[model samples]
Target: MLGKILRIIGIILMGLASALMILGGIGTVCIAWFPENWESLAMMAPYKLIFQTAVIFTILAGILGFWATIKLARRKPNGWNMAVIALLLSLATAGTKMYFSNMARGSVAPTNMRFYFSLFVLLYFLALRIPAIWDKIRFEGDQPDEGVGGLAGGAAAIVAGGLTLTVHLWAGPSHTVNGINYVAYLQTELLAAGVGLIIVGLIPLALDLWKTAVSRHTSETLKIPVIDNRA
Candidate 1:
């Protein structure tokens, strides 16, 4: 019963995030590229590239997230894993924008908020993925999970972690404001988180490898000829 409720909540969150990303992307493109007042936008020309790139990533994440969530709601295979990757990328992409916003204002509060929000989202998603909760949400008639085979989940984690790492690389550890190198404290926080996620991502790979090895051993054992002594 509790699992069912959590599943619904997760779906709601995904839908909300998806809608926000889509609307945000459209608004960004229109405001940054096709502005009503050309002169005002021109004044911000230096940031046009950044805005465009951010919007692209936002839209991509929104689309993937929407698809993944929909699949999960339908009890499709790999949906959970895909959603994990999508959510991570979406969080990282959104965080990058927030970081820049905080930088422009010369305040670190927004970035910190973004990081905290990210941690909450990640924790919530993971809670739902716990085996006990995950199994409870499934109906008896639903297709059996062929298991993740570890590869899909592992790959998703790697992609998500890699994106997080990339964001850290692009943002760097500090931003120069008023000729002072102001270290964005969240930069280090994100870097450490990214590394940890990468390590976590390896679990799927290891699981898959172990499963494969066990399967092969079983197959080889079965292939051995039976002794004729019983006959």
Candidate 2:
């Protein structure tokens, strides 16, 4: 019963994360190409509030998802490490974002902040892939087909991560482009790609949640013991 509830909660949290990703993605894309329009958007406190809220929610969902995965994998001696790494990476990304935001101010080049943000975003995607790799390696014998879903999900994450990395590379250290600082432009691009990848990544997560719930239901009905009962 507890497992079922946790799975349900995970599903809900994943959905919320997906929604936040979408909002963050849209905001990033809009601001990337039309930074001037940001002032207008910012004027709408609700809109800005929503974007900020999405960031916070994504961080929370990431933490919850990581925790749930670790709990589910407790029986598996080897998987806990991957879950822990993912959790740490997610937290790091969120923490770095907060740090950058705190340091950023008007018309100032956020060189260090942008670099760290990009690096952390890359790590976030990489960390997310750890579980998929572990699942593939650990469950291939018992569940020959089980790893396929995670592999696909991992591939998607890689693509998203690659996009973010590209944005980061294009956004080099403070430089000049058309009288506008390149760092500023890079910041916008990186922000857009980061949010976009996060949004895209959420789709697979939602699917994973749905699949998890279905699997849980099926397993419950079968009444098969998953582990040794010996004390």
Candidate 3:
């Protein structure tokens, strides 16, 4: 079970991290280079470069997180340490962006997906270190099928994709930029979240299906050795 859980985590982090890296990089570049053209971005004109650097760090942290997850799947000794670093970096990035963005926009609260997921995953790691919980998780660690995780991961990806899209649709195209730029509605965070989920979900889900198919094919085609005892 632990093994399968590790694999699922690996699949989820790698795919999500890859997607975030691409999107975050592009967004940072766009914000820095074309702040004037965007109403929301324009607000950060003075701090465009700052936000860009923060975003870059976030992307780097995500990459490290991906590497850490891979190491964990392989049962590397330093996997947890590396994960600690990645999660801290991610938390720092989230805090920095939220703090500065809120100050700039005159908002008291601001949040991002990175903030929520990193914090939760990190907390989970801490909880696992407890002897009692670790016992349960490791009870059937050596058992096969451990397949509950794979199914859960797939179902979660689908559900996340569906919910995000639903919210995006429900929100409609009507975003407000400090009482201005109605056009920002077309480019809302919900829209980005929905699209990101769809794209990110495709990676792990496709890989899961592909592996299942190959495994089935190999099982069907493989020949077993047989011997006959004759008098």
In candidate 2, what are the lDDT values of residues 1-231, reduced to their tens digit?
A: 333333233323323333233323332333234434544323333334433553554445455543434333222343334433444544454454344434442322322333344344334434434664434333123433332434343334444445455543443332333454444545666667666656665666677779899999999899966787796
**Candidate 3 or 1, higher TM-score:** 3
For 117-138, candidate 3 gives per-residue lDDT tens digits of 6677777667666776555443
For candidate 3, list the clashing residue pairs, or say none. none
For each candidate, the alpha-carbon lDDT, in order, equals 0.57, 0.42, 0.58
What is the full ranking by TM-score, best candidate first? 3, 1, 2
Off-target runs (Cα >4 Å) in candidate 1 are 34-43, 105-119, 139-231
Worst 10 residues of 3 by lDDT: 167-176
**CA lDDT for candidate 1:** 0.57
lDDT of 1 by residue, 65-153 (tens): 76776576556777677767766766776676666645553444323433454456557778876788767755222655444323433
Off by over 4 Å in 3: 2-22, 106-111, 132-231
RMSD of each: 13.6, 15.3, 6.7
Better of 1 and 2 by TM-score: 1
> Candidate 2 lDDT (Cα, whole model)?
0.42
The number of the candidate with the highest lDDT is 3
